[model samples]
Target: MRIRSLTARVLILATLWSALALVTIAVAISALYRQGVERGFNNLLRAQLYNVVNSVSIGDSDSLTGSPALGDLRFSQPATGWYWLVEPLGNYATAPLASASLGVANLAVPDVEATPFDQNYERYYEMTDDVANHIRVAETEVVLDDQGRAARFRVSGNLQVVEDEIAFFTSRLYAALAVVGIGGLIVNGLAILYGLKPLDRARRALERIRRGEAERIEGDFPSEVQPLANEINALIDSNRRIVERARMQVGNLAHSLKTPIAVLLNEARTLEKNQAEVIATQAEAMQAQVSSYLNRARIAAQRDSVLARTEAQPVMERLARVMRKLNADILFELDVAPDLTFAMEQQDVEEVVGNLLENASRFARTKVVTKAVMTARDDEPTDGRRGWIEVVVEDDGPGLAPDQIGEALKRGRRLDESKPGTGLGLSIVKEISGEYQGSFGLSRAGIGGLRAQLILPAVTKDTA
Candidate 1:
């Protein structure tokens, strides 16, 4: 699996190092076990050699003799890989006396003049004999009080027994180490996941802030990520202050500029007929332009503020009631989800919905319908900040041509001068939706008139 999280990275690095350490310890233990087995095997052979040396005696003719039986039955069996011998050194007038296991074959003792004995008065060697069995031999130079001469006493035991013991120990060791390794890795993985859970909570908190469901990242976090949350909260507050300052400035400027234009229009009434008409027309046009742009500036300034959601269903139902009162001759239909909400101020929703419903009422011959739905983005998962609110309004009057729909959205562009409107209603809706990173479009309705579709960001419980 790909390691994408900090937990996975820590688990992988810790597991690799721990596995190395376990292997090192296992190897050291195996080496010590083998050494212990060898030391014990050699001690047994030395004891047997000392027993044989003590059994020898000197005859009246100054000859050596010993035929004592060892306690082990293997020592009495021929070619059984256990043997002992006591023999005179340098022509002492006596032949060698050996265990029955030696039979007629001589023990393969290495030349000892070139080899020195250890502090225990014994020398040991491992060699293979003509019988094809590997064995350990211990030899000692003995001086008997009953005899005037010295002799060599040697004893042997098979190395195959010690090797079998080591093989058994190694199998058990491998099984034990394997169990420890697997168990350790599982424990380490769980520890890593538990240690990093705070980071996961922080990530979810950030998503809630982006969706505008919350104003700041909440709850306590680990020290490593706490500073990041604080910084993000500071930035959000700073941006809100800046937007508030810009809105105040725009409001003041509109008041200051509109007064002079109002005075000019009033003074135009006292001039000549043609000059009065021109000044009055120009002043009205200026007033329309100023109002349109200033409203757009105010909406833009407040678009990024983290605030409470505005419910769409209440707004739609309220507008439907008012529109019905104004256009008593037309039937108004309303369909909206009660929980549907927009991630913007309530005033913004009222402005956009009111304009669309008013335009529908003006043109519809007999019927108008408004619908608001909470929808999920097709390209995003249905969680957190992936939701949208869509409000659609339709009428049954004469609809616009496909080409005329584009022109209707432009400011001050009216298709029919016969219609009683400034041609700024749809333009205002488009500009407000754009400020919230939303969409607005016109299409032919099923009722034969125009359809205004507005899609904006939505707030959901998961985001909160």
Candidate 2:
């Protein structure tokens, strides 16, 4: 069994959306079901009230024992959830006990403009009971009813019967939501796991790569993520080869320099005191120059050889960690878009930051910051040729002068030449930025220190 890792952010978003969708559907279902039930409830009351109205009349005896013959009054107290009222005067009527709370006596006659004559008897109203439950009504004159002309009958009932039914429906709704909620969570987890199974396999393969067990990101991954894995593996392979080759070449170069280095040492010993001092001085300077060029070659070789689409944040993070390991008391911050990637290779990006950050770390008082952001020029449309990258390297140190900044990027133009730097750091940046068809600028940072902002051309390849 494989477990797929989901991003916490994306997982939260998906779950909320699912819960919202299910809740909306549940509310709509309850609303429609309640509407239908109430409609039927009102209609049943209307028919019952019509019957009682037609059956009533003014009698000489006033005993009120005889039921009206015009309309059928089947039973005196029917078992059906229905009731009726016949009011010869304002407060004279007999209605079911359920109608007491529904204020069966308080119903007002329908006003004209809003409720028409035919719609009067069909209209229903709700009222609360003593225990705060709902009830319904259908009260009107029997004269306009289907039966022959008769007295009026007002129909009413406690909707608790309907309320109880509504409660049952509400319970079922919650039960369904619980079922669907729990089921949906399970399904969501399963779906996320299933969807990411390929990534899990790819992860295992990537682990093999870390341990040198595999050469590339080759796995039985799904098509959606395979390309990413493959590209990463390809980049890893290329980076490894470039580093290994550079290491071997430098080793060979060092070995060849050893003999001349040893010869200069021996020759310096054969000269007079002052001449010997000059020779020794010249020999050390030569060795230092050779070392500087060799170091520059190594850095440039890396930048030139990285030839795969690379992610900047992970690469920068790894590099920043390595730098901190070497120097324990530096605060390194990287503000970068995680998913934003580039066509530049890993080592190439590494070389860009490696030298500059190494230089910044050496000069900074406390903190060094590296930031890479995806941005577009204000004049340029989003999908057009005007988008650019903004890479910033800043340090809180005494700033460089505007005139001195440009002159400092030359191969050997160190501001303080005595300070043991090859001056290849910023030069390499300028060269690489140009090669990438981007612009590089050096200025005073917002924090009153040196800032190097490199704006590169957008990733203009066939990414899709």
Each prediction's whole-model lDDT (CA): 0.83, 0.65
Cα lDDT of model 2 by residue, 137-212, tens digit: 5656543223332444566666766777887998999898979887887787778877877877887776555433
**Candidate 1 C-alpha lDDT tens digits along 31-113:** 99999999998888877887787788776677777776569999898887898888877657577788888888888667766
Error of 2 at 295 (Å): 7.8
| Model 1 accuracy (lDDT, Cα) | 0.83
Clashing pairs in 1: none
lDDT of 1 at 117: 88
Please identify model 2 stretches exceeding 4 Å from their true place.
1-5, 53-82, 88-116, 119-135, 143-150, 244-464
What TM-score does prediction 1 earn? Answer: 0.79
Q: What are the runs in model 1 whose C-alpha is more than 4 Å off?
A: 54-64, 67-134, 139-153, 167-183, 204-214, 264-288, 291-309, 374-385, 460-464
